[model samples]
Target: MFSNAVKCRQIHLIATSIAHYWPLLHERPLSTLTTTAISQEPSMFVTSSIFIILYCGLSLMLCWCDYQSGLLPDRFTCPLLWVGLLYHLYLSESTLSSAVWGAIAGYVSFATIYWLYRGLRGYEGIGYGDVKFLAALGAWHGWSVLPQLVLIATILACVTLGIKIIAGRKRQVLYNPLPFGPFLAAAGLWCGWQTLISPPP
Candidate 1:
């Protein structure tokens, strides 16, 4: 009788333990849910992060070169242009038609301004490299970001020129040929980040 009573108590304890743990066992874990979310959209996050890093690094390199030599070489700009086109082709983030048009529009618009300014002033206002840089950016981010790039670059360039003018009387001349590459490159990177992080409607 005692053994039977003990068996009954043991069975009751087992049942109580299972009841206590049942809710936990059935519940979904936070970590599991997080993992599932990551799995669902892993490509977008991973590719975007990689592109950001690469784009920023490339911009920095261009800025440094321009700062040192007031020049933007074809070596860097050419690669940037090609890579952007290839990236879009492979990823389908944008149509090839859009990228081609963007590249053409970017180069032509800047070239038009450059030639017009040169015709009136008898000197080039912006370099060929600057035009190529814009073309590359447009190809990568599409024409949508071009306006933002131009606006940001213009504001930054104006601010920089203002500062140089203010400091010139007290100090040496800032630059004989002011380098617009850094400003353009910085603006392009910023606009690219903006587009990548929060795509337009």
Candidate 2:
């Protein structure tokens, strides 16, 4: 009888415990629980994170190479352009037609500016490599954002030049060639991150 009573008491405690916790469990919406579960898991964002890292690594590498050598190698720029197309094609993040048009526009616009500047100044104001780099950026971001990207890069480059002139670091700003690739790379990376976080509608 004592043993039976003890078992009954344990059962009663278990029931009470369940009753106390049941409201807490039931009160949580399934969506809230699902969200919490998803938040705790990092694998869901692994692919996006990898892509972001790859984009950043490539952009930084190009930036460094341009700063050090004043050249943007076709090896890097071409691969970046192709990969961007492939990214959009396979990922379906954007239409392949858009990427192609972007690349065309990017190249033509910059090349036009390059030739016009040369015609007016009798010298090349921009390198061919910079043109290719901008094309690669367009491949990744599409033509929609190209204007903003160029504007940002131009603003950044102008600001840097202004600072250098103010600091008396560059006496002959026109004579001293400034590599535009780094500024373009920086702007591209910024736009890339923005695209990754919030894709275009």
Which predicted model would earn the best TM-score?
2
Candidate 2: lDDT of 168?
Answer: 88
TM-scores of all candidate predictions against the true structure: 0.71, 0.73
lDDT on C-alpha atoms for all candidate structures: 0.78, 0.83
Q: In candidate 1, what are the lDDT values of residues 1-201, reduced to their tens digit?
A: 999999999999999999999887767586678888788567766765666666677777778899899888888887777777776675564466677777888899999999999999998989988899888878777787788888998999888777878976324333376688898888887877666564222
Off by over 4 Å in 1: 1-44, 93-95, 169-175, 198-201
Which ranges of candidate 2 are over 4 A from the true structure? 1-44, 198-201
Over 1-201, each residue of candidate 2 has an lDDT whose tens digit, in order, gives 999999999999999999999987887788698988798556536654665666677778889888899888988888888887876675555467788888888999999999999999998989999899889888888888899999999999999999989988886676678889999988897787766554333
Best by the lDDT measure:
2
What C-alpha lDDT, on a 0 to 100 scale, does residue 105 get in candidate 2?
86
Clash count of each predicted structure? 0, 0
Model 2 pairs in collision: none
